[model samples]
Target: MNWRRLWAVMLKEVRQLRRDRITLAMIIGIPVLQLVLFGYAINLNLRGLDAAIADQAGSAGSRALVMDMLATDVIVPVREARTPQELMALLKRGEISVGIAIPADFERRRIDGRAVAQVLVDGTDTVVQSAALQLAQVPLDTTPSANAGPLRDAGLSAAQRISVVSFYNPERRSAVNIVPGLIGIILTMTMVMFTSVAIVRERERGNMELLIATPLSRSELMVGKVLPYALIGLVQTTLVLLLGIWLFQVPIRGSLLDVYLASILLIVANLTMGLLISTKARSQFQSMQMTFFVFLPSILLSGFMFPFAGMPKIVQWLAELLPLTHFLRLIRGVMLRGAGLFELWPEVLALVVFTVAMMALAILRFRKRLD
Candidate 1:
């Protein structure tokens, strides 16, 4: 390297970068997106968790107990339950994050200096369980019973006898929670990456003309490109499932069919998303970069690495748009909680819509003619 020649080459490369607007946009966009997700969206200090109120006490003191928990900002009362059975139903359906069951002897227990309420928490996410534990220690200032007013450590350990029960994950094993979500993250990464560059690789390898010459319709061609990888995705799913069971002891509580059904839906959806990116990308490198754009949110906001209930409402809304978010819920519900597809129908429905939308978009964006 001569100094003058090196300077000239550096400037030439800078000009080339300036002209490739997609690369330039990615350079700026990726960091900004990461900052927003990590700084604003990813929150571990969870609050406002969905809670069901089963006020069997139906007394002023019991109402005060509920009010005190609400004041802590640890949980949001989403529905009223007249009985503990109904609250259990909601938890089984994955409808609420926590359930508060106030017994008929709530006031009497408070008067006798006992844990007055039973708090049932969805323990799939540890952060939320920690929040529930924190909530259990909350002091009720307006209790009608003077005896209850002095106690703060309700049922768990000492005074505030808030019997906090962590359902579905009584042992609080990290592997139990992580193994199920890991499957979704793996499928998302591999399936999207496999097909994100499919069309672009075909174009780069000089096979675009052959594809164009074929009599296969665009829909047929798109589906064909994805079907093989979809099978690979299923195989990956099975491998992860087996390894998790053997090594981590993560059990599949629900029907194995439900797990595969949800995985298939997610696999197809992610593959189509990749195909969509491939249709838009001019080269394989660009396609891979775009795949990262889709992957980042899936990892951060899809309840894989952080608590979904902890994120702000707007960030939660954004997370809802990612297919990985729905799949995580579906898989975890089936495996950890023994929930069926009927119970997780909303997530199943969202995935179906996502798969259809991505497939349609990929087909429409695909062109037979090379520009």
Candidate 2:
């Protein structure tokens, strides 16, 4: 090997790298972005999880119990329900994280010492389950102390007071949570990969001129490109769900129609996103690079692998921009919590907005003339 020749080749490669601005940016940007995300944006310790209180007793004792729990900061109070059933419904709809149900017989129940105030936790998310379980272990000895609070005045003291009920995946099975999310993950990867290269492949194969000669409107062309993959996306959805159910024994407690409705919405959004990326990318490789740029954050910030509540407030805001975040909530709500479409309207609306915005961007950016 000639040492000079090796040096010359290495220098030439470095110069070529500097010339490709996009690649150069990616080389520097990917590492920095990952550092920021993993270092600051992500968190394992949960705080401010949305929660609700069902004070059936509506007494000072109930209020004190709520205040004491709120003081723990394990959860944040969001809604107030009239009954335990209403609180459970809110949980089923994926509206809140913790549900504190203080029974009408709050003081009387503690006399025998089994479960005084029932606390229901949505166990679909193991992170949340672990965090909210702190309430159950809220120092049983404190209840029997001589504190002059009204709650103590009510004589609500017991060895076991808060009966924490883990709803949904009672056993805290990771598969139950992961399976529904896998549907979104699979669709995101395949649909985006399939269509991101569509336009680039056309240009690569010398089909751009043929497409240009056609009289098809940009909207028509964009729709035509995305619709085929939308069907494929649904097909992929069915396959993943079937495998998840059969292999992992993940239960579908909610209506299957609601699951399909979520799948369809997510499918279109992902397809349109790919089309949008396809319009921007000049090559298949670059399109995939961009897809990966979108993909990494989608998985980390989207609450697929980590708890959404665990992210910083700004990170949570950013996660909301990704369609996968909303899709996970929708699919998980229906499959694990037995929730209906109407109950999960916020996610549905977010997906609708993302789909329309992506399709419109793709159509607007798409041009007949070759670059």
Clashes of 1: 8
> Candidate 1: RMSD over Cα atoms?
2.6
Candidate 2 has what TM-score? 0.93
Clashing residue pairs in candidate 2, if any?
A: none
Report the lDDT tens digits of candidate 1 across residue range 137-237.
Answer: 86754344544445433433423577889988888889999999998999999999999999999899999999899998999999999999989999999
RMSD of each: 2.6, 3.0
24-130 in candidate 2: lDDT tens per residue?
87999899989999999888899899998888887666677778788888889888788888998889988898998888876555444547677789999999989
| Most TM-score-accurate candidate | 1
| Sequence-dependent TM-score of model 1 | 0.95
* TM-score per candidate, chains pooled: 0.95, 0.93
